[model samples]
Target: MEQASEMGEIGREARHEGGKDEEFRVQPKWRKFLAHVGPGALVAIGFLDPSNLETDMQAGADYKYQLLWVILVGMVFALLIQTLAANLGVKTGKHLAELCREEYPRFVNICLWIIAELAVISDDIPEVLGTAFAFNILLKIPVWAGVILTVFSTLLLLGVQRFGARKLEFIIAAFMFTMAACFFGELSYLRPSAGEVVKGMFVPRLQGKGAAANAIALFGAIITPYNLFLHSALVLSRKTPRSVKSIRAACRYFLIECSLAFVVAFLINVAVVVVAGSICNAGNLSPDDANTCSDLTLQSTPLLLRNVLGRSSSVVYAVALLASGQSTTISCTFAGQVIMQGFLDMRMKNWVRNLITRVIAIAPSLIVSVVSGPSGAGKLIIFSSMVLSFELPFALIPLLKFCNSSKKVGPLKESIYTVVIAWMLSFALIVVNTYFLVWTYVDWLVHNHLPKYANALVSIVVFALMAAYLVFVVYLTFRRDAVATYVPVSERAQAQAEDGTGAQAVAAAAAADHPAPFRKDLADASM
Candidate 1:
């Protein structure tokens, strides 16, 4: 009886310990999720950058809330494309840049590097202008002086990464929230019709003049090119284990975190549009405010919030714009580093690299600001947006091809539904961009100040380049992935090991003919 009683006690202890174990398991699931949160936050900042603000403000001031649907669609597509990048990193232990280097020849790689660098520089133009405009608004500095100041300010922000990527993410995220709070606070005051905002977000319409162009710009701002390289490389910083369950779990957690981050970004974008729409279209709008709305730019966005924030409007708007511009500058710098390191296998200190890109980006901005002042600077932002739109296909085509490659991701290739959706969205983007480019070029040709001979020569060169662009995109789309970087050896070995099969034999066979190494470290590994 004593032995029986002891056994019952033992059973009770076992049950209690089991309960504790279950609780422990459930608790760390969330903790593990927290570990995956920083990368998505970093990527989501790209969505709320100054470029996005420029497009959002224009869309709202010009068409009220009619273009909110564009933001929704663009963000949905951005989420899909970004997750594919993360999946590529997690599954292959390599970022998109590294993969591109391995897959392309030396000449092709050089061309791609130049194209990506141009994309980086073009992206920085708006950040430079937007941040400068913020400084001018707040400190009452000349726009040209403010443009020069942007060169030094971003270097200080980049210093945060010295602590760690997570710390930098925290800093960027804080800036993002600051911008959100400022806009949403203004939004509450304006109180645009909730029904109209809902309809604008769900129902797609491009009724008014220039609405189509604004929609294109809005879409381009949201889906940035450098963001793909940044997201893919950022995932490598997490050090996920090389196991099926761990990889799958990491991908799932990253997606959820990314979705949440985008939701915050989307709301912030909506608030910007709604506030601009509400104030610009108000019956009580002053003539000066009406004139500003008739031609809204970042420099004048503060006027929209004048009645709401009163004398503090410029200060509040400048603060939000500064956060928007500076946060994106930091993100752009990080992306430039990743692009250089990934494609050219070249690495530099963050400040040095940032200074180089910033200097290049500053020249055009300074010239426009000094020559034509704030209006010219605003037009430069739109020009930069168009450049980004044109550059998107180069980065995107390769990513789509890589993600759909069975050899590149082995058993982790994207699903049929995902593939179909990705292609459809991509095709739409390419068509819109091509049509716009051709239309703009023809429009310029028809109304140009150039000599006819010079116009003829320019037209030939431009058409040739456009043709080359389309051909290259077609090549990448149909290109066969000749290399297998992420084989199914790990999965196969784990399965076979349970039945006494040797894992080494499987790894050996998988690695035998592989040109690229199976494991790639972000710091030292070369493709």
Candidate 2:
């Protein structure tokens, strides 16, 4: 009886203490619907980035829109996956990353931290560059200064979350409008063959050098790793009633919202491809368009829009780019916090988290920009995705285990069909990524000028390391996890109310040291 009272106090304190907030609240019925639509907008913005643009551009210019079907297929997968993210948050009252921290082994958690952190930084570079380039195009601010300006402005805005999450969502919403307007403007002006556009959307084909890579880029952009973390966490920002039915409704609404948003996003992605294909595939083409076709950057996007569309296209395009960058930056910051808190249960200031990411992202970016200009920076984004591809196994394998288990999410969560599809998708992703890694390694070995002996030795070492990594990933896939043994809602309420007394100690100790700083984020297979 005494222990039960102590548990009750602990629950109450956890609920009340710290800056930790209850889920977000919508004012009226209409507001809930409106708010339901928010995350997908931000999510779409993440994929509409310059890097993703380049992929769409390359795919279209080289393959002439044959690979456009990837957008539709990819979004289908994305909708399913993102809904799972939202459901996790709603069902567990915890973010995916936090759940990961709780469920995964220490070494695995540490590795996940490093990889996830890297993915954020890599994702941020394009955001920084895209925004910086936009400022230069629209306002004549130099790229470097513009980057600093972007980091500063975003940080300032983040500082004002005191106002509320809804307000931040509003700003991001405006940015979404801007992105939509810019793409539509470009689309209208280019006036590409509509029949062909539809055909492209439905068709699947690839040809020529690096076409496969471009397709992967499109997929990677659309179904980004960090966006999963962000989406799952963002749902928590909503104040859904702590009832199963209410949470289920909220989940369903979010699914619809994300679907609509992703469709719009899919359209924008198609618009970008069509615009680039139109501009670059110009038979009487200008030198600039042809050359830029091979490699489209943020600066090139606006110019292409202007030439293809009307004069206002550049302004519209730049505005969209700015929105893309800012939205991504905000989302990245959120995910970073999720990672920190989820794994370690640490809660640093938002500025601190953002700063850490910006510093890590900018340092390598600055070095590359100074040494090799934009291309070097661009390569960093690609390599970062590659790293994300490597790190995906850790996050995904564990997430799959959790949702599939009766313990963590309970049996009522995902359906059997959903589980099967997720695994199928996961398998395809791993194969594609792993295959590419091997191909790149072999190609590197063939091209490098090192002595045969040295080359052989290096190749062996690289092969061994990759083998180990793959083994670990495969191991996670085949293993079973002890689920969280989730409690019923009534029991949950009881637990929370009985769990308050040690709140400070719990929160503070969890804050002191990251529980899995250098670990691999691997879950315990048995439990």
Candidate 3:
């Protein structure tokens, strides 16, 4: 009777295991896709930030559809780089910054961290300004006051974490969809030439003044550096499966989700350019409207929209701007947390981290808004975007190196075709951005009517910085991958032994290393 009871228990356990496997296999495709949605949407926010909006507006108003091809190119590159970032996290169980910490020398890692932090701050400046601008429009508050308000508002957004990361992602996704609807509605109203839009996307051309600068700005604004960090880290939040088939499925789902998100972003951007180009370039524009188009600032963009979508459209524009700023700021906050913790191996409460980032970002924004007023704040947004343009190579080069390294990723390293294409894209971006950097500085030196001695001194300093920048890029490009190449056979044997013993020893060692429950809690909560 005892033996029969044991046989019955074993049969039930086998049926349960089979059912679990069957359930996994038969899970609906849509549900799987939905599970992988948040990270892509979060990363997509960077592509639609206020900086990108400003550049898109300027591109359309200035060159009509001539620079649309740049947007296409930028999105394609963004998709490629972001996929690599996602793959790195899923395969290695480590984010990019952590890998950098493990791989690079101490000093080099420190420098990289500083650069990454700078990129974060630089990215934040535009969001701060945009949020402030939204407040200036919506509440009749001064830009300086709005800048102060942004700090608190961001904290409130970060507060959504108590609910869950998915809550925050959902809120941001709603904002993105809202923005897209507004732009698409405006696009339908204005009826920009579909032919011109198509030509602009496919046929590469850069005509007229400021086209090159605007193109570089578009590239920078679209394919952000910090978003790479954010994407790799964000994927860690999802509980992806460990089996090879399951990993591949998760990757494909993520790629589809990211592609879809970026496609939405790409279209919204195109719509912005289209709406601006069509409305501002109309034959019936008033003299004031024409002048506004000639010098399109964020403040003037709504006024231009008012001409087509009626006066009420400005409020809609402001609402969308608010959404853009708030959503992107939240994503930036997460990126900041990931970057600090990964690079430093130190953790902080999310609120504390957000406050620190906001304070640093707010100081300059507050000063600029107060000193120069709204117009000055607008110019600051453009300047901040330019800073992002220059910082791209610093981040991109390292990402390409890590993703392509067979030793680092082992069997999961990218294919040769992917490696070659990625490097080519990286090289092209470096060359174009470098050229833009050199030419813009030279152009300023030539055009500025400063005293020769003072001008010469400034020029010397600028060129020296440029030289240093090139040297650093070269260093990153050729840097050795120092991450552990192989685990010794003995170590593997010992690990297998520990696993055979049920991993109690491994768990104890981990507990010893991370003794504080609060620290582990903080890290887990943040992830």
Candidate 4:
């Protein structure tokens, strides 16, 4: 342990001095195993985004215990997929975005980056709006003021990462645990029927029109495109030794860590639903809550908590909401950095990136907040999800392809069965999400949901935006980059036995024997 520590310090100082003082040697034993613990915490908090609160709240309110299964499915897959990402990152020195850039072509890379940036901006919009809503409810601050405040608050958090990624993880993890405690306390107080909770979790049923949408929202929150990119890249922050045994151990522990995170996320979801359901399902809902029951917003939830769960519960709920939004902001900033660096190979200071992203995100947020303060938060969430829906194919399609590729991901390659099933599922999800987005946008375009008749000018502008969005989707589905050809391992083995890399003369040769195919396949690779 002392040797590894000394070696790390030596390596750092030597690098700092431009190799002038080379003293440290490579590690005798890799410390990569220690890195698996932090990335899961980051990914876990991804589930707690404010958008998720709405979905979880809806799930519990409408169905009571029936949709606990959403959380179950979410956690199960989050662990399964994130471990794959962590394993890939630890095995390969590069992060997922870097791999994508190395794997795909220029135009394709830029397209993906644009999509990811949009998703990040979309994700940030909610955090901005949610913070505003919380400010409005608790402090009676104007929503516009809250928006400005959130950007500054997040800018301050940008400094926290200066110490290290693990520092950011610990801070975020503490907040997540605090959120869990608050909800778990609520769950205990509510004492929701255990049998019903179990039944809801195990049995999958969509009873109302809202059921399907709520289920979709829950699934969308759990398996987000940004989180996938975020997880893969985050695993690369720590240096892990690349060896068979150590890689395998890292993979195993990551699985455990991710599974645990997912389960905790599940309980939090259950708590949200339980809290909402208890109030909505109460024998005596007040007329105002009952009247607005069909359309609950962030503003509605705390009041419900205060009435049903007590004023203390309301305080806990708001505090947790603040923690949830802030922790999510931490990751949103980190993910933005990875996307920018991976796609562009440009490194900016954390604060610069945070300021740049928050500035862009805050404008649309400010306009919406000022024009439609408290009520607009819900629209902001739906719009964010819609943006995520549009960006889904960019991230999801690449991950599916890369995970299944033998040459790129190696023995860690997803099984043929896993590939087929995962691809089918991913394609179905993208289609469904896209369909919803298109429908929503189209409905807005045609009806103009504003009071009185539609303004032709506004409708025309919306049409243009929606058309551009559709064009982007069509490009993703139909676009083809230069596909890299792969020589099978068996063929490579036969070649090696014959004359590949002049096998007898070369002590280590696979890296040399490998073709330039990964370079050829590079167009679609950016994260």
Best by TM-score: 1
Candidate 3 pairs with clashing backbones? none
Q: TM-score for every candidate vs. truth? A: 0.87, 0.83, 0.86, 0.77
Worst 10 residues of 4 by lDDT: 17-26
Off by over 4 Å in 3: 1-28, 160-172, 307-309, 485-527
lDDT of 2 by residue, 242-302 (tens): 4344566678888888878787777778887787777777788778667776666667666
Q: Lowest-lDDT window of 10 residues in candidate 2? A: 518-527
Candidate 3's displacement at residue 326, Å, is 1.2
Question: What lDDT does candidate 1 reach at residue 251?
Answer: 90
Q: Please give the lDDT score for candidate 2.
A: 0.68
> Global lDDT of each model?
0.79, 0.68, 0.76, 0.65
10 residues in a row with least lDDT, candidate 3: 512-521
Order of the predicted models by lDDT, top scorer first: 1, 3, 2, 4
lDDT of 3 by residue, 69-183 (tens): 9999999999999998888776666788888888888888898889888888988888888888888888988889999998888888778667786666566667667766777
Which prediction has the highest lDDT against the true structure? 1
Alpha-carbon shift of residue 319 in model 2 (angstroms): 3.5
